[model samples]
Target: MKALVFDKSGLDNLRVREVPTPLLGPHDVLVKVKLAGVNPIDYAVVQLIPVQPMPHIPGAEVYGEVEDVGEHVKGVKKGDRVVVYNRLFDGSCDICLSGREMVCRNGGIMSVVTNGGFAEYMAVPEKNLVKVDLPPELSASLPVAALTSYHALKEAEVKPLDYVVVFGASGNTGAFAIQLAKKMGARVIAVSSKPWVAEFSDHVVGYDQVQDKVREITMGRMADVVINSVGNAVWESSLKVLGVGGRLVFFGGLTGSQVNLDLSTVYGKHQKIIGTTGGTRKELLELTELCKDCRVRVWRILPLEQGREALEWVAKGKDGRIFLKP
Candidate 1:
């Protein structure tokens, strides 16, 4: 099988090369890759995450068809269209039993700790596959961005008529945040560089004008929740927009991770800062249903051979999703 594999710790090290097809265990399913979502985190996986034993394949979001299944795979069979649940977990663990498999102590993320689906064929456990009714393109786009956005909003406890401000509102997770907030009955204030977010948000403002716009829209009460998926670049601004006792939910940190937190302001305002990453398998299923009719902008769909270029395009910060057609 041909795949985008990186042998060392740099984007420059990534290349398309022939590798052995993954052998399935008794409980694994072999998937023929159809479309794999390209995330900025893929680069981070290659550059920082300790992808053990070298020659690592780094694709975190996958949508594909089951070409074959291990003997023990009971729920799905050959020819099933599915999306990969990128988190690895032992189903019998306490965390898994409690439905918080995303943070299982014994589990790790796909593409980071194990080889992922940027290839012609990949083998995953049966529990990690979710059958979907959407097209390959849309299904491929959801596993990372949409799932993360949906979980963050749930964690923030957004309510009807609440004021929700989303930083990076035009980016991957941010775009989903805008639509999901409105869907949940919140008045969304989108802070973004592009005007396209205006289609879904109650108010759209640039980062420079976000504070004032949020204040005006909420009539000085400020935002009930702020979703800052952009990270350190918008940390201070995200905090500034939240009303007293408001919740601030953050997931990815595309703009560097380090940030200065003011202890006094947090204590005095009684603010809650919540941190989350990928969501549970249950949330992923729920998100797919909610976004079934949604169509996201696809900037490009390149062949698997152009994996390096796709990652470069993602690094340049485009406004739409990118996918690899294997």
Candidate 2:
């Protein structure tokens, strides 16, 4: 099997090499990766996360077909089309029991702790796979990115007619955030520096306004909820644009993580700062339904061997999700 291996040295150390195929556990499913989703974290992890072992395959989300299922697996079988939740959790953990599995203290993300989706095949826990009937119109390209957006919106408690501001609106997560916010009946304000994003702003239905600058668009009154995928660079401004009692959901730190947040306004304005990670099985299911119904549009697709190229694009802050077809 061909896999892109990452080590402590950085992406320069990444190599395309033959590797042994994964062996399945009793409760695992063996998936033939049709497509894998690359996140900014993939790049960051290469630099920041210490290499656990040589030849680490770093991918978190995958859209694939089940090639084989363990005897203990009941929900899916061979030939099933599925989307996987990258965050693997111990079923008995308190967080898992309470349905907040993504935050399970004992179980973190797949790419960070275990072999991930960027390969010809991956063995994942059966509980983490969500079987869906893939729609002809919906390709594997956008599922993970869409699911991330869906998770952020649900966590932020976005309400109809609420003023929602999405920073980095041109990027994959931001693009979906814009569309999802609109679907939830929120008046969206999308911010992006790239001129090409104008196409998205023009076509996507719910954005009330699109701008290169945040302050100019807000016109003094901030949004009720601000969805930020770009960290540090927009952190201060993101908080600045939030109205009193507004919610700010942070999903990624693409820019950098160190930001000086003013704790004063948080108390005085009754503002809430929330952090969200991956989506739950229920959210993924709902997202699948939405995509199937033509409520969400997939952005684009790339091949799995283009993993390095995709990471480079993400590092440069390219617009839209880049799918890696295995």
Query: What TM-score, over all chains together, does every model reach?
Result: 0.97, 0.88
- lDDT per residue for candidate 2 within 1-326, as digits (tens), equals 88878755487777767889888888999999887767787886676675445568887777789999888889898999987788868878888899888788798788788877788899999988887777522435344577778888988899987878878877767767777787788877767665554544422222223332444555655688988888888888787778888999998887888989779988899999999887787887787767654332344566656677888887886655666676
Using lDDT, give the best candidate's number: 1
What clash pairs does model 1 have?
Answer: none
Q: Write the per-residue lDDT of candidate 1 for residues 138-239, one digit (tens) a residue.
A: 799778988999899999999999999999888778888988888899999999888888887888888897788888889999999999988899999999
lDDT of 2: 0.75
Could you list the CA RMSD of all candidates, in the order they appear?
Answer: 1.1, 3.4
Model 1 sits at a Cα RMSD from the real structure of: 1.1
lDDT of model 1 at position 213: 81
Clashes of each: 0, 0
